[model samples]
Target: MEWGMHGWGMGLIWVLVVLFLVLGVLAFAKYLIKG
Candidate 1:
């Protein structure tokens, strides 16, 4: 049970990191276009 929970937590962190990176790229592109 503990191992399963640990794995799930890691997966969630990875998902958040990926989402943050994608958003950062999109924001940078938008800034360049507006500038």
Candidate 2:
């Protein structure tokens, strides 16, 4: 049970990281277009 929970936690962290990266890229693209 503990191992399963740990694996789930890691998966959540990875998802958040990917989401942040995608948002960062979109923001950078918008900035480039505006500038």
TM-score of each: 0.84, 0.88
Task: Give lDDT tens digits, candidate 1, residues 1-35.
Answer: 57698899999999999999999999999999999
How much lDDT does candidate 1 score?
0.96
Q: What are the lDDT figures for the candidates, one per model?
A: 0.96, 0.96
| Model 2, global lDDT | 0.96
Residue by residue across 7-35, what tens digits does model 2's lDDT show? 99999999999999999999999999999
